[model samples]
Target: MSVVLLALSASLLFLPGLVIGLAAGLRGWLLAAGAPVLTYGMTGVLGPLAPALGLRWSPWVLLGGTALFALALAVIRGRLAEPERVWTRSKHLVVAGSVTLAAGVGVGLLFFASKGFSAIPQFWDAIFHGNAVRFIADSGDSAPSGLNVIAQPAAQNYFYPNGYHLLVATVHQFGAGTVVQALNAMNALLIGVFALSMTALLRTLRVRAAIVAVAAVLCCAFTGFPYDLLTWGPLYPYATGVALLPAALALVVRALDAPRPALVAVTALALVGLTAIHPSVSIAAAVFGLGLLAQRWLTARRVPPGELLTLALLAAGALALGIAHVLGTLSAAGGPAYDWAVQRGVPEALGRLVFFTRSFDEPQWWLILPFVIGVLAFRRLLPLLWLLVASLGFGLLSVGAAAYEGPWVALLTAPWWNDEWRLAALYLLAVVPVTALGLVTVLDLVRRPLPRRIGLVAAALSVLLFGYLSNGLYHQRNGNRLAITFGGGPTVTELEQQAMNHLAGLVRPGEIVFNDAQDGSPWMWALTGVRPAFGHALAGTEGDGLGKERPLLRERFHAYDTDPEVRAAAKALGVRFVFIGQGFVTGSQKRAPGLVELDKVRSLRVVYQNPDAKIYQLTEPDGQRPADQPGKTPPGGPVVVSSSPVKPKPTSSTPS
Candidate 1:
């Protein structure tokens, strides 16, 4: 099954991507103008279908799919004309190409960063929360976690978007799960391609813009100015969004600025592509579309009725998708339910302003100066400024940094973490615009010698600082050491060999392992061949906003805080085996009276004990198995997993 999933993942990504590319040729106009919308809509459609396409392929599948897609594209070549390249003066050509190459490498570096560059673990959430494996194990097949604005919230309920998973699953063919090296290579490649696309777009801009473009690319690669500010591992969805957003924006510029069916089609397709990257990026594209239209209107003596219609329809389509996703979640089991804090009072809104509170939070050190200059230089950049303004307003309004406190507000505006050291994702809200501003600002200051270089230097320093942090995390996880021992030793995922070996002794085919501040490590590396009974869960699904399930999950957690209830529940569910982890007081048995620690489980045999884990067996053998166990292999067919793990009942702590 894992093998098949890998093959299918490949087909889904490159194969369909080719079809989408070809679609650009025939429905050239539709594809161009609707790129974001189509991608967004298709995600909803394909997401649910991904699991049912039980067929997984191999590298052979990749080869065939690649060939087939290439053939289809070639066949459509006659139907598609080359987009008119912006004419460049002879003096600027060489410089432009050089700058373009620089940009590509710079962006590639950023992409490399995503592949576990920082001290932060790559695929942190998926591994710890166990969402990726959980859903796959639970549903028997991976399904879409995100269906866009139109998917019933119920439909997206079980899934949360994770870009790496989609790619890994395709080649995995057998749900081989995520591979750090493979994902790193893949993202590096994606960054390269995405950068190339941007370079092409920049070629059309002033040559001066090209040189500055390298800096912009560098900002993305090296600076905390925005995109580089994540600590929660790699942000697959957000980075993909940033990568694709530029392409979509370029198409829009071409479509609107060039004013031809070809360009219009290009813009449409870009819009659809925007939709595919992530709903937020799509929404941002729509905003870009509006900006284009507004600029057109302002420049024109009169506003064209058609442009208005186009914007209206484009927004409406995006809106429709949003509605569908929400509706779907409402109906699905484990759907995200965010209805608890609708009219969140003024006090709560003020709390969300802190940016550096969670796992990924860092002082916006390099971001500080450029942002000041950007504000000074482009007071007129209303859209970008609005992002800042909104973030500030949201922070001012939140009572504290509670999740539900400002999800609706964040939904209206992008969520900003005031203190993100450990929890959450590296969203593009700050990165994209900040990169744009830094690039633009650095471009203006290129000829200027001293203080001018300060921004770039600060930017570089910022990258090094954050990169050190993020990269350190990645290295710690992917490091080659067998085991470094304690705090000074094999950190985070860089678990010592001895600890892992110790776990292997105690863990059987299907057992629950609860460990440490970070929970997903065991599943990603330790339980690769077997199913885990229980692991960690994520508290941050607020990206869905005002979700009901979040509240339920919270309630369940509170109720189960006592070891007695959690243990009884685990036992009832046939989780007789337990692996207690380090860095956390994970023992549900801790809350129960007269309950012994797994380490001291005299009644139940101690199977394995390490610095990182303590594996234990239940005192009663009957408690180990259940009529219907989660990870157990029954006499029937093999288990098929879905992509969307049931969104943990958000508020209830209730097991799904």
Candidate 2:
């Protein structure tokens, strides 16, 4: 039942955008692929606007706003005409079959890889993202302008993109499932969106139907994308932006090809959505757009003045935004200078780029054959070739940053925080269509010597053979990564989560649980509706306004009976309980200073205990139980503090 709701909730992301796209005169695949782009655009706009308009942020707002916008567009365009017959029955079937095949691969990969709908990713960023969704749901404020309040309640005018959070929060509010379930659903949805959008772009480029179909499936074959991003940082928002990018580029192509005002307007809106989701991916889309424009200028005998003007304006606008972003003028929370040390030598990095492998992952050597075939057989497709080269070149420079830290590399890579994973994902996006073309080229060569029906059978067998050789879209390796990311470690375990659920029932409303953030305590609010004093691992220590109080509690909370400051801080924050988990997020046995030896703290009493976790309620100065939590105890009798703390065995593996 939860899984069904999750699927339904994710499908809701397309409704508003579909309505708007139909009103804007978009047709066929353009309407189908472009809807999610517009959905995100609405999220980006309405997330911040809802608060200012004195309206609560909800899916209803998005739906109502979309209706209004679509109505306005229809009014401006004069009238809604009858839908055009854009494709024949056969072509429609081909498109549907291709998109479904690709979406099935993507959704299947995510479903099994993630273990289950309720499992939470244990990566560092997941801590913040999970809590952020809960924060938005609880506070009724989805604005990026104030989202940092999750970490620091006193934060003012901070900015981080909230479009991803808004969508997940919408899912949670609609009763899809828990916050973790909604997160997994959103991830699956983004993967499907990526496949659909990439297919639309291939069709827009006039690729043959056969190639388009193969390319859609190929989009999920690369390990560097949609999968790696899911494991490494679990970079959900960045993934969402990349998923929308192909459609945004397709819109750009459509607008430039015909130069209509409505097309240009819709293209601009899509870009806005892309930017709000992830600025770095927006930069990538801009680069691809510029490359396309350059190709047009060099190839066309005569370019229309309007098209040329649009190209110039786009370039200028991109430049202006880039400048503002680099100067830290775009938001109150300035862009971070992410400096990841080089993980490979130049030779190895270049080899990985050729195989579409990010970092030390297994290389897909099979991709090279088709890539070479496509380049050699279809040399006339210069734009595709150019994009392929550009993506590879950028990926090489990014992955080999330590070997080549020139000013140009710094300028080009800064927007992505100099991260190679992001650059590699972009390269994977380019690889899909080219690789599909190469596969089709091979099929053509084989088909020329055979009868029509036999040739079709051979082609089908060949595709199946390719999939078999690719290990069903590299499922085993990706599934293992997902398992490790979502499974038990020091960050969380089944027993620990069970204890968290138990703790939820013991606490009253409006009380905070004092806990070690590194022990996955940050997930408490999202999973159990029990607020933790520290919302993130680095929250109190990293200028999140908790200041001396958090540090004092971290070091001396177990000393509450003897330390006035610790007791005072606990009282001030309304902390009624202390939770101790099995181990640290890094899988270390070292406990937080204040959380250790809590069984010896006379001013605290064990309210709950399990093999992997323990919860203690703050007691009165005279060692009496607190008045608020009356009669909450273990199964048989009154609670008793153990003489010694229980130590559970810790897992060795850490989150990636």
Candidate 3:
């Protein structure tokens, strides 16, 4: 019942995508409907900084901003003439989009078929720990003695952002509890809009172009191609934000085609959304814009101020939101610690940035043939191609290489890289027109009694390339399945699940739990309704390792996990025990030298022990928790507030 209600409510977010799709037929509303979703998704990236902006939970603020945004776009859309969306007869587009969408879903399924989706029940880690964890931190209720953070001893402090959680949370604002359905429904709607946008954008090329691009993007939308699948960690805001990004880009394409204020405004909204969803999104937007502006200046000096201003404003909104979150954490009386994405050591920082390269998945290898053809035959496609170029160049720069920390990919695909893949999604959309342009010309020629050999060769090449990419992914899924036993015996996955379930069984209905698995690895927290020890995406820390170098850094991590100190930190705001998993965490490099050597393992009795994990009841419960532990706050006062506040709704869709 809760899920049903939430799913229904999530429709609020989903409707925009569908409406935007349908509105592709009604040019005036296309941009207006699409803009906010992008803005919302990007904003989702802000982490603990949102509240300072005076905008986080203020629906009216969003409503007003949206209204203003809509008005701005309406004025512009009204003046522009609609494109010729007579719907072209090109079957290429149909096959293309179908293939692409299929590729994405297929890739996802392929992975599932490979590993079987952790039959151990990932539960809400994909969402709750991803997003709600941030809410706890941003709300300044973070403390270590409460949930996952306090329990999981000696590990990396990932504190991954909860993109899935945010997605679900945001949906809950409108929907309530069943956010998963909401997320899927919303993505489906976006796919529809994505299709419509392609059709409209290439009215010159028609339905065929639309179908090809939409299908291709859809295939790549949630999943990567067959050959190269992604390794996921924690919930990524950028990935879920990608769900909103396609339409947002479609709006941008719309803006370029018609140059209406509405489309630009919509584009601006998308820019804002991208900004909010992930640092990569924000950085990509900024870099991509610079590239576009440069191209425009060199070739066409007559760019409009409205277009530029809209982009700037959207960035500002994202910045404001992000900054607001930072300020909140920095100012908290017993504020959270800092985790280092930045460094006192540039070389080390650069080292962390190395992995961002994993994000580089170029458009289909065959994109080259289509691109050349499109460039030669369709002049208008130049602008679209350039946009693709800019997005790619910038996305590469943005995914600029970062090492993976925790379960999430911190490099180019920060947080939720798994579920969303926003950067890749947008880029794919831009490249489709180039592809369509090429195919149309080819088909026109192939129709003639041209050499049968040429057509056969082209067809064979296309199939081989597609199959090459597809087959690899099919097999990759097979590789994800691995079996490990705990304590040389118990199933690692099962034991962890049992430990979590055990913890959950002990909690009262409204209690909260916390864990110290950093932020990204929500496995420990997701299954049991607990707050993560670290803030979202490890935001709000001042130094490396959960930012403990910041004064009393230890205290903040506790709070981020919804320390018992905070009224609503845990399910009952009371964590009865901490389950440290040998399988779940490998410990951090930065820990004190003898940390792991200590009898910490010998000290705690195992509630459940296996070769893989040992669930332990704390030698000391929350009230009697040791202050010396990493997340334990100094003994200035109680570890908890007198009366815990109500836990946030289960249905909420935060970025996770």
Candidate 4:
């Protein structure tokens, strides 16, 4: 039942965009592939605007806004006629086959990787993402401009893209399920969108339908993309943007090919969607668009004036936006710049790229053979060659040459934080299609001399062989990685979750729980109805107002019995309970004395306890006990006996 509701909610991600695309005269594969990109644009625009218009962000508002905008587009275009039949029967089959294969492999891997819909990705960014969804749902504000309110209640404005969160929050608001479930459902939908968008791009490029189908299967085979981002930073918004890039590039191709007003408008809408989701990907798309334009200009005997104008305007807009985004002129917080140290020498980095590996994943040396074959087979194709070169160059620069510290490199790669994983994913976006084409070339050569039925069987066997050689689309390894990340002990265990569930009954409404966020206590708010003082693990120290009351509380809240300052801070913060989990989150284990020794605090009475977790209610600072649970413990005395006793349970599980 939960999965059913989640599926239904996930389908909502397509409606607004589909309506807009249909009204704008998008047909067949274009309509199917373009809807998700338009959906992100609609949500990204409306999320911030809804609050200003004195309206709450909801699915209805999204649909209504899409309707109004789409109607305006229809009126301007002056057409609502019957859709044309642009796709052939083979095209339809290709679409179906591609979507099924991509979704089956992509969503199937994700399902097992997550363990279930309710399990959260135990990574750093996931902490912010999960809490951000709750913040939007609870505060009724989906604007990224004010997202920092999740961590700091008094934050005025902080800029972070919230398209992914808005989409997930919309599903959550629909009563689909928990935030984690909604997130998982949306992730599954994005995987399908990635496949659909890539199909659209390949079709626009006039690739063979067989190659398109092969490309769909290969999309899930690459571990660098949609899967790596899911595990690494769990960079959901960036992944969302990356998923939509192919479709946006497809629109760019269409507009460049014809320069029709409607096509250009749709392409602009796609870019807006990309920028809203993650501006870095929009920059990447711009880079590709520029290459396409350059190739056109360099080859054309006489470029049309209209085409020239269209291309120039696009280039100018992209340049201006890229400059603004990199300069941080678009937001108050400014653009992100990271000084990640070079982890590998140039030789090692280049070697990793040559082997189709990124970060620490196993190398896929087989990809090189197909890529080389495709390049040799289609060496005359300038656009394909350009894309191959440009993507590989960017990959090399991001991974190998990042230590250069040049201004040009910094300006270009700053939007991505100069991260190697992100650039590697972008690199795979171009290489995968070429590799698929190469595979098609190989199958075609083998099929030319054989009987039709035998040829078909041989192709099927070859694909299966490829899958086997690639470790079953790399699912086992990626799934194991995800399982370890999601499993208990690294972050929160079943015992800890149960204890939090039990505290849901004890923690009253309008009360804040002081939590050792390092111990995964920040998830208390996400798992239970009770609010935590810190919404994320780093909320206590990372935000503004360091060396203030919040940081003091974070470090010395357990000394409330002996420290008047701690007591005052806790009282002012309205911290009624303290939640302690088993240990710190993975890769973030540090002994926080104030949070660890809560049992010694006389003012804290253990209200709920489990082997791996405990919840304590703050007693009055004075000697008097609360009327509900009368205890005879004086202030600054030894710990008061609790009604619930803690018990020891043996366990061998270790944090990953």
Ranking by TM-score: 2, 4, 1, 3
Query: Candidate 1 overall Cα lDDT vs. reference?
Result: 0.39
Candidate order by lDDT, highest to lowest? Answer: 2, 4, 3, 1
Model 4, stretches more than 4 Å misplaced?
79-88, 301-304, 311-329, 332-336, 359-361, 401-411, 451-454, 539-547, 622-656
Q: How high is the lDDT of residue 537 in model 4?
A: 63
Most accurate candidate by lDDT: 2
Where does candidate 1 stray beyond 4 Å? 1-19, 22-45, 52-82, 89-140, 145-157, 162-164, 171-178, 186-208, 225-229, 255-277, 308-527, 540-572, 584-596, 619-656
Writing each residue's lDDT as its tens digit, candidate 3 over 364-425 gives: 33445554776577564555545667646433322332222333333334322322223334
Give the whole-model CA lDDT for all candidates, comma-separated.
0.39, 0.72, 0.39, 0.71
The candidate with the higher lDDT, 1 or 3, is: 3
- Per-model TM-score versus the true fold: 0.58, 0.89, 0.57, 0.88
Residues 414-507, candidate 1: write the lDDT tens digits: 3222222111122223333444455456544553453856855765565456447545323322222101111111123334223444455545
lDDT of 2 by residue, 154-196 (tens): 4554567777788788888877688988888778776678878
* Model 3 collision count: 139
The ten-residue window of minimal lDDT in model 3 covers: 482-491
Model 4 backbone overlap count: 0
